[model samples]
Target: MPVAAKADVVVVGGGPGGFAAALQAARMGASVVLVEKFDMPGGVHTSGLQGAANEGVGGIHTELMARFEAAGYIYIATEETLPEWTGNPLSHYEKMKKPGDRFSRSSFNPEGAGSIMSAMLAEAGVEAMFGTAFLDVALNEYGDGIDAIIVANASGIQAIQGRIFIDGTGTSELVARAGAPFVRGGGPQPSGADWDGRHRPIPGGLLWTMSGVDFTKTAAHQKTAKDPTLAKLIAEADAAGDIPQGLYRPRMTGKGVYGEHYIGHPTLDMSPIEAPDSFILWQNVPYEWALHMDDDARDEARAKSALRGFIDAEAQFLRKYVPGFENAYLTNVGRYVGTRDGRHPLGEYIFSIDDAQQGRSFDDAVTSPMTKTFFWDGFKRHTFQVPYRCFLPKKIDNLLLTGASLSFSYETIFMVMRNFPWCTQTGEIAGFAAARSVEQGIGPKELQWDQPYF
Candidate 1:
């Protein structure tokens, strides 16, 4: 017989979504249990090596940033002072700003993010079980509520029961395990029909980071002059067949410090479930660079080969074309790929692209000002709300899901659902709702979607 421990609420998968859910539930006075496969929290933001938080979903999301700032973990990107150009105005005109300055967006350090998230979870006093994997969910005899969850840890399989459960797993593992209906790759399985009856898989994506950069020197180089050779090289690289067009953009995380160049490639079928560690690269290479490599050695070789190509190309560009980077080095790559789309649960409300574009605010809006979908493209911005119905499955009365796997359409996902902050916001709402439902002694489905909370 397994030891059964009960809690007011149970949250599985300790990523940003799970952590926020657990923290918010505990703060609301619920005895919450947060289970994570890893030893620490912050999911992609910490372990995955995804770069810093952005300013989108405010309120609780803003509070997370405050904690990081209060802990001396925040940094600002500053503009470089450019030197005066000589000769014709266009002849020696200086670039004035770093490559990342093409867009005005805030960025942060991953190390800082990890530190602050760990601190926040510790301060919240939520009972966290790290290095634990959720095996199966035991349903009530009526098949309406989740009676207990079986998890495998170092000790063995333990059955933990809770009045309410929140699934923060990006893959919706809990919801699927509980026998709830779900759709992977942007539509229903087998047919892949979306809400509007279109076919699409959840958009698969990747994120890589470059290191060995001299921030100060790069800033200086940008300010001193614009070299035509460098511009040509950039244009040439942009035209490369493997590189995704229009997805390459620079993001500065710190002032005269670290930065990132985002390359969004949708054709690469590197799903989170299939290639969790595929994003860590030592260099920037063609998207099909892994096609010929052996399956067993692909991951390792991809990192090395891609990184070498990236560094060498960058070095040549900086030395011969760009002004700075004469001594730039390749630093570290991301630990996990920055996934944009994945499997989502089938729920009562499937948020669509039309809803997102129209700025449709739900009557049961858990959080206000659900903004538009902000994808890799720098120019597009859309605001939309996440209805409470999206959190609960139509059939499952006890289980709730949040994060990237929430109920939404492929068009909606492509439009507004890809935002990470929105996922965090949804997570917070799901946690609060689950706790409230448990305290009220009602099935999660019974909670009014019109006005989620009294």
Candidate 2:
């Protein structure tokens, strides 16, 4: 096959991780090429319509948020407002009607974020090949390093050669294709039965937004609306076939939404983003359907098709039943469903939940100690650190792992570190390591972990 391009580092899957990896490497004076399946970067945050960043400490994440704010592309809720709004519930309804505090917890315009990603990559002299899909890898003579990757795009099948490759595919697709060992079926199950694809991986969801919603009326109704009444409407919708079949229960995580059980009251479920009339929402699929992710492509496609059906049904139901959504319409649907967990390429160290809960630290730490922010309200908010060894594939000499594909066990730790900010941090570390490895004429594993690189 013809060689499409050559660079010092080649990054696959231009999501948050891959995008940061490519950008950082190029900025470090390495020739970089980033390949993405979609037309834009930002992965789930863009194409998947997951436009929110709940937490960010430093690094590219904070910088990106600053740019988004300057460009008028984001809505931010500060740390102080975060607690106050959660306390008063109705405060979110009022606050969201106006501008937010600053860029702490943020929701952005996905397209605008994508444009920013493109501009950053371009400015750093990185060749970003969007609309390109990874096909396979070409191994070197020793079978320990990748010489190039085979890809397909509108330009047809071609090869992208690089000295070092980073896999941010979120499913460890590159390492899997390179014949490296990885943990699958929700990571280190005891019965060994889950590895056979019998058990579901992490729960996956699809996000979409609706415009022309009346938040004022929705908030007023939420103040006195009874759960029994909303549940009855849902039952009626199901009876009338307005709701999708096979348990189409969706929950809201957007602005102006009150309480955790917003699923019971669909009117209070949608979260406002960018504008008061615009809101983002998501729905979790059945366990049987979620099990297909990264294992069976055909089945995954079927699951997505079912999700689209749910989106249509829910949109119609909101317009007909909800008081505030009398004329609500679907503003946009995500390009694809976002998978939370999948294949994890095994590394020298598999960061486990125990490590996270204990707030373990290592000499080879690549990331600053991060707080325990995922799902567990009761667990102590201890800080955990990620080491550089977690990014190195055990069998692949020239490949590094980032994003959800990193060598972390599936559980609370994955949920904590899998956010866009954390993923970008991992990418920053990996990119720096790859560029240094190329410059020093050594494998990534041989490099000494330097704290200043972070």
Candidate 3:
């Protein structure tokens, strides 16, 4: 097969990180080609139907949010904004208000946000090949650097050549295929702890949307109905085997901590402001299932099939049991399942969770020191800086890692720095570094972190 397209940078996966990398590289005057299996951009946030900007972010992410806000696609969740959409009196947020509440995230319309992202990529001159899946990669004669990547789409199998390649597939698919060293997620290990690869990874979830919900009725019932808290109803349903066996449940555990789950679904306002009557729901798979779903095709198919069944059950249960969901119906399902943990390509430096909590600074930080990000552990906020070394995958001269697959302890990516803005920041640095390396005619590892690449 002949090479379909050649560019300075070839990016696989057009999620937040991949899209940002392509856009930044193109803006910096490097010819770019980004391939995504989904038809649209904004990976988990768009195609996955989790259109959440969990926290305030800067750099390319800030720009993207600005665009969304301008397009009237964003919904900032807050104490004041909550009641408008659901008609429920804000109790939780009001009680837990803090000085750092300014950094809270906003939700948006997934389809609208995706279109805007596509437009941004095109405007930045990034040639995005949507609905394309990565097949294989061709290594240079020395077997040390990638030369071209094999991808399949409607046009059939083709090769895309580039000087530098970015593995933004979130799971580091490119890096793993190129024979680079990577670490698999080994379920809730401490920062920098060793893993034997025998354990399962963390749990993953699938998100879907339901439309035609009566938010006001739901809120009113939740506040005044006999089972006002929904605890009794959920318990009754669970006892009757109505709720899915493995679905996660949220709990209000004390003041600062709210347990280990997302607050929505059964109660609370998960509806996007664009459509107040629509609710976003998620079904989480247990770690035992997630381990197989990460890399095994057959297992993934099985898990996805099971998840769909769980989603249907949950929808039915909601309509039958929940007061506000009598007329609600499942509308859109995310094309991709959301994984909290998977393969992480090792880099020059593995950022640890301790680094995140302590607000550790690096001499070669790619992130601005003023950028405020937080981890969920007690909701601790920090001004963390990501080093440039984390983007450089070990044993790969021309390949860079981005997104959740970048060098970090599983805890770090899980607890913090895996949000939209952080991933985009990493992509911005990688794209800038890749373009700079190409222009300088040197490997990415040879570039000085402190030097001005631009």
Candidate 4:
């Protein structure tokens, strides 16, 4: 492919990180181009219907959330009254559907998110190349920086040149392509010689949604101190074959809240599918092991189909034994699978577990303290700061890494990464840094986080 266009900054993803990068760079007066392999912009947050941005956020996050709110996509969780999630589903978001103090969540329509991304980018003067996938990179003659990137689309292969490249690709395809060092995603280290007592590597899985659920009824089934009927229903289901014998226990609740493993199967989050309607919700099914995203495409597709079967069985257990889901039907499944781990480009500095929870101060910190990041180990938690150097690579002169693939040790990555708000905040950092790099004719290797990129 021949060089098709030149951009002051080219963002290689369309997720929150990529979207924020493109918009931020452009707002800073750089000619920015955002290329998304997918048609929509929200990526997993939108498509996976994450439905929960529970961590409190601010900055551009405030603006984007306002749009989702105005569009009636934001649903705040509350410790108080949550509406009857089932029945003639109430559009009014009040009352916790499940029992106990409910954490507020924001669930939006994926289709709506696509439009919001477009408007935000356009308003910021960013040019977007949708449905374009990044392939590989061609480094400059000295191999110190990228010359251009090759991409594929309907018109075939084309080259996109930019002064700086931001890898918000989630998988860190650029780093992998550039033959950079990264951690391999797999099971957490086992105990003993293989065991590290502190590091429990939880497996990752895919997210899928179901529609036409009597979420009110489903919520009722999630027996809390306030309610017991849902617990009773699960007890009955477990006695019967519907809930699976030894391995399956029908907490019959949202998976995120409880990482319960029942019968013979591994732990799974039966989170009440978070959606606009009460009757519709998705279960983020955990896998037997963490998925390898770099696996062959055909193999990956087959694996997804297999995972869907397990999820379908889980759904069937609820429908057959649970009270609220008698007529519940499968409306949709996630287009992207959730990976707990991925490529972690070695950066100038990587935040550690202690840094994430207690909050470490970095002289070059681009994120505010209000931008909360945490790692979860059952009941325990550690919060930390996301430093600018996490995205700044040690080798790539003109490249910045964003999204879930930023440099972090296996022990602390998932706790620190994940979620839309945090990633977008980092995206803004990468964006401003890219613009500054171009303006000063400096590479990311020479950029300093202590100085203002603006």
Candidate 5:
């Protein structure tokens, strides 16, 4: 096979985690190569959500914020205006129409994000390969460590060797392909029901934007406890059989109308972007039901076809009842699903939501509450810190993993591992760990980050 450019660190997947891993390693003077299946970086942050890049968590994340700010691609809308019901009995999702305070986040122009990621990679001297897919891994003669990774791109199939590898792929593709052991999204569903594994999968979503929205008129339909415009609309739609039951549980984060199941309730669910238009909000548009993200069942072709059809049906509802969206149009549908959970890398450590809630740390912590904002669940306003062991494969010496596919179970991944901010910091940690391992002639499991590398 041909030889793809090798580096000290090879980060597969150019999403938020891969972006941070590659950028941090390269900035630290390591020859790094970042391979992405998509032509652009920013994974869900750019192409998927378009503006859900939450708060500036750390130096690197803050730097991304500065770039976005300079490009006029976003605005942080975490502060809340509907403070009267701060502690209402109702869940946060049902209390108001515009619910985003603890869930404070920013939005960005996808184009601007791509340009920024590209420019930053170049500035950091990182070799980034887009439209590249990671096939499988070649083990060493002893079958104890990874020798090289097989990849396919415009250059055809090739192999790339590295002292250390970082599996930033959101789906744990590298780790799985390497024959590593992992767990699927099976067990008791959040609804208090057991899943059969094959039939029941975790809930994944895709976010999109609506253009030509009349913000002025839509802005007026904000809901209060006494006058809930969003609830009213859902009721009318449900009565007309246009909306389905169990689609809008209001307080549940999974109940997003922009979801594959329902369209966002203008004022209740979404927020405005920083662009000339602010039609984009936190809505989903993928698998309304269970779909194993790691399985081929949730591949691109199937998700796209299903979501586009839902948008068509959603558009009719938007035009008739929703005030601001009366003239709104589907600007663009996301190319990839904002997958919440996937197979774990089964690292040396299994980071759990319980550990985060308890404010856990490790002797080799790559991220702590001090280095960056810890534990942001956007849904429950939860916060916690992550340890370095979460990224280390339990048995693989030369390989490491990061991002949502770290080690959390289906029930808890969304609360911690999957958040883009945390994933970004973890990527930075993975990169620095890979570089540190190379410099010390050691493996990532033996790497240390008890001190601040950034």
Candidate 6:
């Protein structure tokens, strides 16, 4: 027999969304238990091995930045000290600034992010269960809300109860397991359409880290318009059939952080079905692409083999394209395949591309910001407003979703909100709202968005 524990609120999946929810709810005086499949926190920020935390858009997300800075986890560079790319010095642009001084979007050291996030949750008195996966949800006879959760860990399966539940799983697995009604991909295309209507699988990008990269040397080569020795190396590798072609627009972080762009394909976006008992509010494009793949055993093996090839290609690119990477090596694979999006529960007001482009404002708004839609290549100022209704499912009570899975249209999701920062903000709001719901003994639907709680 497994031991049982209890809490006022339980959060599944310890990513950014789950972390924020657990911290916020615990601070609001709710006893919170945060379950995670990994041994640490920060989700993609740490495990995904993605470069840094983006803080251009602020709020609670900024709080995490402040924490990172205080812990000495950030890199500071200035225009005056900007490394020369070529004969001309590459201009140093301030992306994020601080009060009094200019704040720049400082990239974080992944090694530090996990520790910092864990510390924050500890400070908030959140009981964190690392390496634990939520197996099933137990509901009361009335089916009002989740009564307890069955989880699998090193020991085995254990049941834990809570008054309220928050599903921050990046994939919406919790809600899906709870029997929610969710939709994956847009419905069937018109008849006779060339679209096989099957979700196609694309190559997943490789995540790699390079050290000893002398940003100064590469920047100087770039400024002078000279053949960037680094680029030459990459070209050589590609010609030798080591890396894939079409690798362009490498994203550089200050001096050391860099990423390569690869292939992307359209597929069914993964979104959870809505249920009377639960709601899903986070979704993204990357998740959809992976979920749409054929689930046949042969297909699964092929996908893994393809992923290995992608990783090898990336390793070769680093060795041949950039200077200081001759000694570069693969650091770690992301805990989960790099997923982009998931199922967005149907909410009262689904955010559309028009609303995002128009910078729509709402009377019952929980949060608003001017930001780029996810994965849009063009330069434009697009801001969006999160309506209160979007947080509530039509039938579910005492539930709120945060993270990338919020209700959004395909156009808006593809164009905006794909960036990770947007998900952080939504997660913070959902966390605060969940705490309020528990305190008032009412469902999130009952709370008036216009009313001032603070």
User: Which candidate achieves the best lDDT against the true structure?
Assistant: 2
**TM-score, structure 5 vs. true:** 0.82
lDDT of model 2, residue 125: 97
Worst-scoring 10-residue span by lDDT in model 5:
255-264
lDDT of each: 0.58, 0.76, 0.74, 0.64, 0.66, 0.57
TM-score of 6: 0.75
Q: List, residue by residue over 217-327, the lDDT tens digit for candidate 3.
A: 765676676554566667878898888765434432332212334322343324443465666766666443434556778867776888798788878877988877899
By summed lDDT, the worst window of 10 consecutive residues in model 2 runs over 254-263
RMSD (CA, angstroms), candidate 4? 5.5
Any runs in candidate 5 off by more than 4 Å, and if so which?
A: 76-105, 195-199, 219-268, 281-288, 298-301, 369-385, 452-454
Considering TM-score, where higher is better, how would the candidates rank from best to worst?
2, 3, 5, 4, 6, 1
lDDT of 2: 0.76
Q: What is the TM-score of each candidate against the true structure?
A: 0.70, 0.87, 0.86, 0.80, 0.82, 0.75
The 10-residue segment of model 4 with minimum total lDDT is: 86-95
Report residue 11 deviation for candidate 6 (angstroms): 0.7
What are the RMSDs of all candidates, in order? 9.1, 5.1, 4.3, 5.5, 5.0, 9.4
How would you encode candidate 1's per-residue C-alpha lDDT over 365-432 as one tens digit per residue? 77666455343233256776668888878678878888866887654554256456766777788878
List candidate 2 segments past 4 Å from native: 54-56, 77-105, 187-197, 223-225, 247-269, 288-290, 374-378
True-structure lDDT of candidate 5: 0.66
- Which residue runs of candidate 1 sit more than 4 Å off their true CA positions? 81-105, 186-212, 215-331, 358-361, 369-384, 449-454
Enumerate clash totals for all models, in the order shown: 16, 3, 0, 36, 13, 54
Error of 5 at 258 (Å): 17
Q: Of the candidates numbered 1 and 5, which has the greater TM-score value?
A: 5
Candidate 6 has its poorest 10 consecutive residues by lDDT at 267-276
Residue range 1-454, candidate 5, lDDT tens digits: 8887888888899888889989988988889988888878888877675566556877678899788888877765433622322222222232443343354445677867888988899899988998888888998877668888999999899998887888888888888887777876543443322323443444566666777776445445644224344667767777898854334444324322222223223323444555434445344432335556565664645655665555565666777777767777777667677666577667777776566556665666554454222323334434455667778776667888877668665545654456777678778878778877888888877765576443
